[model samples]
Target: MTKVFRLKDLDCANCAAKMEHCLNKIDAINHVSVNFLTQKMVIEADENEFETVMQEVVKVCKKIEPDCKIIM
Candidate 1:
């Protein structure tokens, strides 16, 4: 399934890029995009494991930018 989430307090475009890269590397993820200009993240992942993948995505985002939040 594909999902779009709003991000809060994303620090910079570089961090957004980093998050996009990390999220795309996940096994269940089919595609990922993090847009600093819009403060949003788009993820397409295995439907059966979507929630699990999203949990990991949140962790990855936190690691990239401690203050960043993906509003579920």
Candidate 2:
């Protein structure tokens, strides 16, 4: 399954890249991308595990940018 999320207050492009890298490392995710210019994130992962994967995604994002939020 694939989904796009709008990010709020994503501080920097480097952080976005880092989050993208971290998310793609997850076994359950097929792929992931973060576009700092647009403050958007795209996630492709197992449909059955999408929710759980997203929870992890949030954690990763939080660790990268505490003020950032994924508009679920």
Candidate 3:
């Protein structure tokens, strides 16, 4: 399944790439697409672990960019 999330404080393509990379590292994630211009992240993962992966995504994103916010 796929989910879309809005991100705050993501001001550049590099930051978006970083966020994508962070999410892609998760074993549960099948794919990730982050667009800084739209401040959105499209995540594909196992349906059963969707919530868990989303929580981890937020955690990892914040770790990479402390000011970033994931709007679920």
**Alpha carbon lDDT of each predicted model:** 0.91, 0.92, 0.87
Among residues 3 or more apart in sequence or in different chains, the pairs in candidate 3 whose N, CA or C atoms overlap within 3 Å are none
Q: Estimate each model's TM-score.
A: 0.95, 0.95, 0.91
In candidate 2, which residue ranges exceed 4 Å CA deviation? none
Which candidate number maximizes lDDT? 2
Question: Please, what are the lDDT tens digits per residue for candidate 2 over residues 29-52?
Answer: 999999999999999998999999
Candidate 2 has its poorest 10 consecutive residues by lDDT at 19-28
Clashing residue pairs, candidate 2? Answer: none
C-alpha RMSD of candidate 1? 0.7
Tens digits of per-residue lDDT for model 3, 28-51: 999999998889899999999998
> Clashes in each model (backbone N, CA, C under 3 Å)?
0, 0, 0
Among all windows of ten consecutive residues in candidate 1, which has the lowest summed lDDT? Answer: 55-64
